[model samples]
Target: MSKLTIKTLAKELGLSIATVSKALKDSHEISTETKKKVLAMAEQLNYVPNPYASSLRKQKSKTIAVILPEVADNFFSLAINGIQAVAVQKNYHVLIYLSHESFEIEKAVVNHCYSGRVDGVLISISSETTNAEHIQKLQSENIPVVFFDREFESLEAPKVITNDYESGYLSAKLLLEKGCKHPVFLSTSLSLSICSKRAAGFAAALSDTGLQTNNYQYVVDCTGTQEMIFDQVKDLLQKHKEIDGIVASVERLAMQIYMVSLSGHINIPKDLKVVAFSTLETAPILNPSLTTITQPAFEIGKSAAEVLFTMIEKKKHSIMADTTVILPSTLIERDSTAV
Candidate 1:
């Protein structure tokens, strides 16, 4: 059988195409009686409105674009779930894109938003995003955007962030209190704002403790790779054989640190202490419960969406504000960093 279209539904109900469209959306402009009739006929005719047709005329897809560095990580998976929950509640659609931590990919994704396929955007900058021109451009076009987690300092937009700096400080201080003299910081991005803030917090803590703020003390400009990180950890271990502690910036990197310790026969909290910034549900079940500065990831997503919806409303001339929101991160003390 041939598929049903808006015209078929409109003709059957003796209504205009616009009336049928408005009824389907349950727009206040469409009367309740009309809505009931249109809905009944639509169901009977199996009429499926072309989203693209509506998108073109209304300039609204009712969709939000979510751009992330990667979704393989549990934090983002949870964040997406949170964002999805709000989107569904607000009757908005979600289109996800992964930059894989590539700034160029992030820029391209932002550029694509000019197509008006989404009402607004939520982004976590990639590790390599040094400039915010592309993001600023989107803002200029009146496409209100919100940043969650990895945010840009240049853009004056609502940012939903964790307490990365304080969390880093807390994690590092915990390791030091546990008697780890040479606590190397493992991180993914030196260019990204979140990692930089975290590293700064750690360095501040180290300096305050009278630890040599010397060359070997602060290692920056590291490569991003499991193999590279493993080799770097090995080299750091070899240099400071007495190196007894580590503060990993990302969750996945912490796993690698754990693996390296195993291969080298280093015991946690005995020969070594480890801490990480993570939101993984599996953190507690690791070989040893991992001490971590856990981000309220779902809350971050929820807050980001809440802010984005507000911006979207502003764009639509609805009542709302274009304010920035930042969420706090929680530090969970686990056996891995216990003294």
Candidate 2:
């Protein structure tokens, strides 16, 4: 049998191609009776609408892109699930791109999105991304962009983020209240806005206690290979025997601390206490349950996706460009930070 097409459907229905097309789309122009007839015939004939052709006609790809630094983080994994939930409900396709924490690679991926392959973009930028020119170029092309988690403050794009600063402050206060005299902040990226905000809040919390934040050696940058980070953590623990508490800015740093403590025979919550920003499912199952500042990662992604679709459907860039949605993170206490 010959391949079925809209032309065939129209011929079989004794109707014009335009009429058949509108009926297939359930356009209001087509009466109920006609739409029923077209739909019945389409089912009988096993006729499937070509999404690509339909998208071309409507000038919409019916697709969105999600770009992230890496998917290895449980946080990003949960965010992808949230984003996918919205995409499925909207009957839109999702394309994910990973930049592996490279600014140049992220820029290259953004450049590729300019080819009209996607209707809009949702991005959590790389740690090394200090420039926003590539994102601005997308805006200049009239493509809507939504930022989530990691974002540049200078960008005039919608942002869905957690309260990093507040969470940081709370983490420090929790440690201080637990009788920690020397608490240090461990972060992978000192330049990233989220890390800076978190570190600043941590410092502020210590400063409020009359501890000289400047002389306390409060922030430690752990950006490097896994081995290098482990070595750094080990050295920090050895050199600062007074460091009784730690605020890890990421889950990896927290895990490294655990490993270092084990090797050094340092007892958790006795010799040291630790709290971290984490979405790890294994946190509770660890040797000592880890205390965590858990961000609403899934909600951030869902909100970002919803905002991107709204921009695409309504073309309300002016209203959404300056929009910022701040969600709250939760502090979950566990044995790791126990007094």
TM-score for all models, in order of appearance: 0.88, 0.87
Please give the clash total of every predicted structure, in order. 0, 0
Q: Which ten residues in a row have the lowest lDDT in candidate 2?
A: 209-218
Q: Candidate 1, residues 307-332: lDDT per residue as tens digits?
A: 89877876652223345566788888
RMSD of 1: 3.1
Model 2 per-residue lDDT at 105:
93
Candidate 1 matches the true fold with a TM-score of: 0.88
The residue pairs that clash in candidate 2, if any, are: none
List ranges where model 2 is wrong by over 4 Å: 1-54
TM-score of predicted structure 2: 0.87
Model 2, residue 273: distance off in Å is 0.6
lDDT comparing candidate 1 with the true structure: 0.83
lDDT of 2 by residue, 157-269 (tens): 99999999999899999999999999999988977889999999998899887776666678989977677888999999999899999999998888889999999999997
Task: Check candidate 1 and list the clashing pairs.
Answer: none
